[model samples]
Target chain A: MSVSHPPGVHEPGILVLEVPGDLAAIEGVVDHVVEHCAPARLDRRRLLFNFRVGLTEAISNAILYGNAGDPDRRVLLELRAVPGEVRVRVSDQGGGFDPESVPDPRLPENLTLPDGRGVFLMRELMDEVRFNRAGNTVTLILREPGPAGAKIPEAVISTLEDFRTQLGLTLVAWTLAGERRVRVFPGGKVGGADAPEDPRPGSDAHGIAGTRRFRVPVGAGLAVEVEVAGHAAESPVARVLAAAVERSASLAREANRNRAALEAALEANRHIRLDMARERLSREMELAHDLQMKLLPPIPRLARVDAAARVVPAKSVGGDFYQVIQLSGGRVGVMIGDVSGHGFPAALIMALVMSAAAIYAEQGAAPAKVLEYVDRAIGDELESTEMYLSLCYCMLSPGFPDIAYANAGHPHAFVIGAGGEHRRLPATDPPMGIGAAPYGQSRIRWKPGEDLLLLFTDGLSDTLARTRRMSGEQQVLKTVEENRQRPSGEILGRLFELCDRATPSIPSDDRTAIVLRTR
Target chain B: MSFNMRRFGEVTLIEVAGQLIVGNRQELKRMILAEVEAGTRRFVVDFALTGYIDSSGLGILVSLSKKIREVGGRLRLASLNEDLRTLFELTKLDTLFEICSSREEALAE
Candidate 1:
């Protein structure tokens, strides 16, 4: 079905065409319209047609015939005028396929495939084929010629409309005058001398050409002798032609103004969207940081034990942890861990290790037993995951005077005491989560005036030059020896400060230290 | 951080000359793994020039060291920077394998 044009009026109007079920018929009708209407409005074009309804058929046919016309399938099409281009969209309602997976149809075997050519042809015809929502929605864009055909300003369009209406009324009066004179002087056609022949057709009651012809009365007289013989009035269809030319000028001005306004609006919208995205990202980052911070334990005050511990995180959220917890039976459970990596994953692993330690420590088991339990608890989870944590757990008691600790793939702990010597503790077992290795607690002895017991992470020692020389041990001992006279907190601070001085801005993991001064 | 590579036959000695941080780990891993795959398994990493080793970078080294050991080859480390040497000593990783005083000693071992 199609809407036809009204009679005798020289104004453009939209035509709507609808086709049902038949894909072939749809293409035929669209092709015919393009051929006929394109030329008619090719010059001095003032026609706009909207096809809101038939988009389904047009798109489906493109998918079916163009894409082998598979009958069970459906597609969608949309055509709209954007700022600089005319956009046509054709989206297939098929199981969405990756755009990258579609091989070039120009290849021999691919040429025969029914599904591929549709997209290729559409791509050739359209300026761009943008896929939205993982290839579910596709848009085809086409640009019009000459700056979207010049916008006529609203003020100019209104003025031109009023002038044309007045001119049309005057022309109607002239037509009536010519008809009356012809009827009254019917016999005088033979007697009166013939005036200069009016070359215009009889329908042209007022000879206004295709250009706007300004006619002004030169002298005051009963019959105004206005000169209309110049440039504008010389055309055959002068009156209507004059109105069209004036309308075109106004249109050009209006289109420019509209384009300018539309561009400004688009720019404003882009800025607003960008600002909103930045704000959302900032909020998400803050939340992640807060969650990481909450996962850490509060600094434990070991007043009875005379222990001073300090942890300095490299980033806003780091993976290092050092805690001294009061266990059952008047024993103290001391833990120091370095989760495998940094940032969010490391933070999460640290949290997990802390929770697991808390639960296992409640059992009042031996240090080796606690580690074995922790290994099993995080077994498959840590093995399959990319990030993991390394931990050290020690249970110190008054009866033992020394401590029994288990190391699961972490840097060894230290004892700085009366002997004025610093010694590295042994790892009794392999790192946690690497298929369980046996963990046995080793005993340590301390005498009176045993100044300090230091447990730390690797961040303090692993500098590039030191890592290469394998001299981190020597450096750490030297730093400890130099700062032995300082307070426990100052000693820990000096250790990190020494690390920083050695490496400058380079970070060596997360700095964690727990020092106990024997009173 | 700057990375320096010295190829001695198939044994590639990588001397990392700067601070080792989290951001450069991926690039470091890519280079090291690519070398490993190219049949240069006998490696002597000279961290003497490196100023620091973060947890992320250390993890990469540990994983790489295990990978090399699995393939019937060894990753010998020598001349650790001041801070890193302390980490190795504190971690007791200094005792787990052969740690030499210089690149020549590491290669000789």
Candidate 2:
């Protein structure tokens, strides 16, 4: 290994290494070369990435295929690094292969092959890659990205130009550095010209009888001397010209200041508008969240039933809801549903669905009839919005051996036996929007005071499933089964505890679960 | 690389941790192939912990998918971060395998 710089240069811009033709030597050589290029000041991310992956692939290719793994063969690695750019070359002693014949690894047919990816990776990571005629040598290059600046607004420049033209001054000249003369006059044209010697104020110059000079100090060690020639010192026209010249200087300065203030105000206005939009969106979300929470009928007081239900809305309000209604014939109607998407749209649909379901269920309608009426009310709105919801409604009457229920593609409804066994009440129809009228209903054998009715949305299960090895639904069922002997409220609490403990990998959804035990 | 394998009903979930580069990609291939030989027909490769993968690592996945398909098995990828998802899409391999948002959905399918 040898590291050297040009004879007189202080920085090491060149490096050379002799690598043995072995796979084990690749990492060491690549690392050394990468370390050498650190002073080039390339972007840290690209520097670490492009060089590490590109050089590794290049050197490994040189040893394995170029040298054919011969013990005596040697590979040469060279690095030339300068500020904002880097170049690397790797050469082997063996005869070369055809670079054009390498098959693309991304092709579907070749995707399963594992050995043809080195060259492809090098090409992808490096900005440029080239091969020598013999194919035994390859060069890689990377350059620092140039700055991307925003374009200047043309309005400011044009406005200043227009203001200059309005001044209507003639023979206005500025002597910069006491040598270069910039002439601006008559038709708003400006150009450089050789200037005569300085003229004293109030002196006649250029053979004019009453040539008056006024010197205006611009910042930055420069001044503009406005000469009003061919006019008397005290004439009205001469006085007007002098005042215009004086005002032009101060006006120009004030214009610059005003432009800056204008830009700042524009920027601040943009931010204020953005803040107002954000505030409005959050307010609307809060309103929807409040409405959804308030609409949930408190678990209706029942004489022979222990009913408990909870709905945990996500950060963005989701359409998860549960309604427990008291019926006239001493029956309780339990409804749990999950609208497909989130935000105000889902909230609106949820509100409509809850109102419709409540009206029908409170009238002592059967489970199937209640779902039919709710779906009919929201069918057009769901179709227009292209959204759907899964819903399940169950009617439990005391002293009945079976519970009559209607399920619309809601998969979490289950009957848990006192002994910890459970059975699914399968969907009687597709989801509300997609399924047709005359919703089918089903009956499950209910053991009063012994069995527990468990209903939940996908949010509860999805959240629990994120960290657990088992499906989220299974975990919920297991939790319920273990706590079946406890009060329904306690069982619901345990289920929520499991949900709160699991760390969800994805954005959480609204969770709603209902556990009711009828005696 | 670290892998956590758990069975959710019939679907086998494998959680890949850390970078799956050239050095550690073979271990994942061997693990999945062995499971396939053991008659595990459904699989979900969860990438919630994985941060990076090189081309060679992708090659092993492709080959493993091919091998799994020969035995009438299915492979699904879940929880890929934005960069990893872009890699699969760029390689056009996202179309070859089932890509799901969450492991729950993947296992259910």
Candidate 3:
């Protein structure tokens, strides 16, 4: 089976045999044909099972059924063994029969009758089965299941076919695996021609009698051999075809390696893109958290008032803020706000509100007027981002009997008396984004030098709700009542200490509280 | 193709190896039918080592199932690989046979 030739010599690729039409010859003929097909390099299992069984079935049918057991008749077996496929044709001398008339053996009723399964087995095992119109000649084709690394792409095959035709070659073949050759003909047909010599020497035939062969090494353990009509072994056309085959083979090998490398690179790029996106999001949140913390104004020193405010930022940046501004005419303005959402958007809104409140409150405007000015400054920003803030502003003056205040849906603002009694300054309007301009103003009775004004956001209370038996606001008020006689800074410290001791069940929000007293 | 046969209580278990095709399906049919004739009421065909089966192999299994059912016997198949299981599902034969995931489960049934 190892038929090796000199570099430029022609080698036969077809085998034809004739056997007597007898069932006894079926096994010997099938084995002989299979041995001739070794150059195709099919896998061992497929060669031993599928090809052997399919060829045996075809030969047996040609002998027993096609010839009707006639000893004088002959059956011709023509085998073509190429690089990737093997084709075998079995033709008998007897009259043909219709292949469609065979019953399907898989049917339940036909399952018990085992004689009708030959055609089914042949069709199942072989890659392709074709019958001539007369039905006497049946060709079975078996293909090699090439591994992915050894497969030549379709574009390279077509390119080589173009070069073969242009060079007036009768045949061009390349060794694939072992002695198996991938043959390409002049008209783009592969493995169809059994003869390479041209008898007619005309314009189309290129005035040649026999084929002149040239071989060139293309890759590792691979060579391309081309056959042209007449004695053109050293002609310019032979050299051109040799160079083209060498160039195309190298390009094909490079393309296969590049395609695999490109796929791996694309897979790695996908993971890196996802990781970078997550990293960018966390970095932006940290920057927003820094900006929100730095935007809060410090409590100013005053001759008639003691004020302290504290804010604990959550893991995710939130928009809870407090401001204490000393106004003209010896009055102090205290403001606290909680934005509706958390993140950079809410932090931006909080910054804008604090800046606007400070600008208007320092001008000695009333509590309602300051809120109206702040709302006008940031109303469109809140509406566009679909967020709002709960704000409470109170004005405290020396020797005043009551505190003038404006509450916009701020529920935690209260005036606590020295005797542990508390009064809530309820909402005068809805929150900023939902409430219209000209915000309502009100006054709560205040005992100067005897009352403490406490304001905190919902985040402070929600953190304490998990560990306290009573409501979170009631716990805060009781702690404040117990420490009412201490300095404002100490009272604020105790409130935060109580919150830090309680365990939280959920993600915490920004906690802010302000304690102010006018003496 | 080859198979191993064992008796677990009243059940006869046959483990088929390699490919069960037209070349060796008759041996499997004969082995199962002979056991049924000997008054064996239960059988389990384990396919843990079998890789492939063709149409003729499927045909022989159907005929054996019919014969075993006439004798009031039960036939169960177990441990089919993914490709074999899909083949049975595509042929709509999964419903006709009681299939189990493991050989022990088939023997327990």
Per-model DockQ: 0.01, 0.14, 0.04
Best by lDDT: 3
Number of the top TM-score candidate: 2
Candidate 1 Cα errors over 4 Å, as ranges: A1-283, A435-438, A463-473, A500-508, B1-109
Q: Candidate 2, A457: how far from true, in Å?
A: 1.0
Please write out the lDDT profile of model 1 over residues A1-519, one tens digit for every residue: 121222343333222222222242333333333433432232211112112112322354345443444432333333344343454445454545555666665565543232343344444333345554335445544433222322122333333334446644222100111111111111122112232222333333233334333321111110111122332455454444345534554565467668766755664564455345434433543464577666667656654466667665553345788777777666678888886644344566677778878788867778888877777776665554434567888777755677778877677487876656876677776667553746767867754245467787777666523644557756776677777767777877777777777777625355677876544
Model 3 CAPRI rating: incorrect
Flag the better candidate by DockQ, 1 or 3: 3
Q: Please give the ranking of all candidate structures by TM-score, highest first, separated by commas.
A: 2, 3, 1
User: Clash number for model 2?
Assistant: 0
Please, what is the TM-score per model? Answer: 0.40, 0.44, 0.42
Tens digits of lDDT, candidate 3, A300-342: 8998898999999877677899999989889899999998766
Rank by lDDT, highest first.
Answer: 3, 2, 1
| TM-score, cand. 1 | 0.40
lDDT, candidate 2, B1-109, per-residue tens: 4788999988889998865655567788889988988889999999889856566667778788888889999999999976677667656678777899887888885
- Pitting candidate 1 against candidate 3, the one with the higher lDDT is 3
lDDT of 2: 0.72
lDDT of each residue in A275-385, candidate 2, tens digit only: 454445456557777888887879978899899999987766678999888888798899999987565667889999999999999999999999899989999988755
